[model samples]
Target: MLRTVATRTRVGAVRVVQRRNASNVAVQNIESRWSTLSTAEQNTIAKQLEEAQKGDWKSLSLDEKKAAYYIAFGAHGPRAPITKPGHASKVVAGVAGVLAASSALFYAIRLGGQEKPHTISKEWEEATNEYLKSQNSNPISGISSEGYKGTGYVVSK
Candidate 1:
């Protein structure tokens, strides 16, 4: 019984090794078929490439090198383009719609809004400066300061 169990165990281990080696064989036409391969097949190819790279790099076949490079830098998965076709046109249209809506809102508000306040006039601002001077408002470096040259409340055109 012991002999039979040991033989069976050895045979099972050998079978597992053979299965692994079979899977790790270089995939034929890897470039043409890589994208269409199932995950398992792709993984097998990756593993094969990894093993090939573990040796002297010069010993790596052209296919193995190409496969490794593709796996690392191919335009697939996260490296693929996020935008679909006509994405730029869609973005431009969205921006144009928003701008048109904003322009419409702005014109509507301007036409319906009240006139500018009386305080916005240059004469009113000059009066404000005089009042500030009289009231000692902002005495330090301001309207009430000595030789103050800064424009004070006079932005109206």
Candidate 2:
């Protein structure tokens, strides 16, 4: 008796899988028929749909209903497509926002620990100035490195 029940359950599962495949095939057939219709036929169907009252919708032929469905949603049915909107953008924006906030919090924490904000070392400043002067052909056009104080973790280290 138990073995018979187990066999029946397995058969039911197989039937469910087969039903799903059949459903998919039926949907594909509907989509293909809708697509193959000429522009004039589509327009005529759309006009019919637009003129159709809510109560009269059920009166429409299967083909006409299928056309209406196509009009409502391009290719896919009523359900949303597998691919979602703003998925990549949402992830990128979320990650970027989190990283930016974390870095800013880290910087603020580091800055809080320092009593007097440290300035750039005199030797490093002089060396940088020398390098800039040597590399720059147009001194007036280049950025001025002087009169700026370097603070936070960089200065502390």
Candidate 3:
């Protein structure tokens, strides 16, 4: 019974090792796919991502983001092969048109939603600016500006 138990433990360890090895292989496959991209292609995609980030891509809808990602990813890929009677090119063109339309729609909607933006009140902005200015100019002397208005006080003798 002891020998049988030992054998079972060894088999279990071997199975664990095999699963780990399989996972490693799968990771390597993905790594190879990423590595297959040329440096120039990666640089282009990186630039696209940078531009998208700077252009407020966070406001994009899910479908718009996906479309942009695909367009950026496919920028350096081989052109789709021409099909009989230009059908393939037409289909590709149709997809591109759809993407273009969606992009325009999303862009308009994003811009439209920004017309009446809620902004900080004048009072709050003035207070914030005064606080920042005081912090910058005087470390020890706080409260550069008085909280209350009115310049002076008078009293009867």
Error of 1 at 118 (Å): 1.3
lDDT of 3 at 93: 97
By TM-score: ranked, best first: 1, 2, 3
Select the stronger candidate by lDDT from 2 and 3.
Answer: 2
In terms of lDDT, the poorest run of 10 residues in model 2 is: 148-157
The Cα error of candidate 1 at residue 128, in Å, is 1.3
Q: What is the C-alpha lDDT of each candidate?
A: 0.79, 0.59, 0.53
List model 2 lDDT by residue over 1-157, tens digit each: 9999999999987875565444334334456666666777656555645554343565555654665576787654455476688788989999999999999999999887856433466556566665665675334544334433433123223
What residue runs in model 1 are displaced by over 4 Å at the alpha carbon?
A: 1-32, 54-61, 149-151
**Model 2, runs deviating above 4 Å:** 1-42, 48-59, 69-105, 108-113, 116-157
Q: Tally clashing residue pairs in candidate 3.
A: 0
Instruction: Looking at model 3, report the run of 10 residues with the lowest lDDT sum.
Output: 148-157
Q: Can you write out model 3's per-residue Cα lDDT over 1-157, one digit (the tens) per residue?
A: 9999999999987875565444334333232344466677546545544444454565444543543455456423464334567797989999999999999999999987855433345555566656666566433443344443422121111
Ranked candidates (lDDT, high to low): 1, 2, 3
- TM for candidate 3 is 0.22
| TM-score, per-candidate, Cα-based | 0.65, 0.27, 0.22
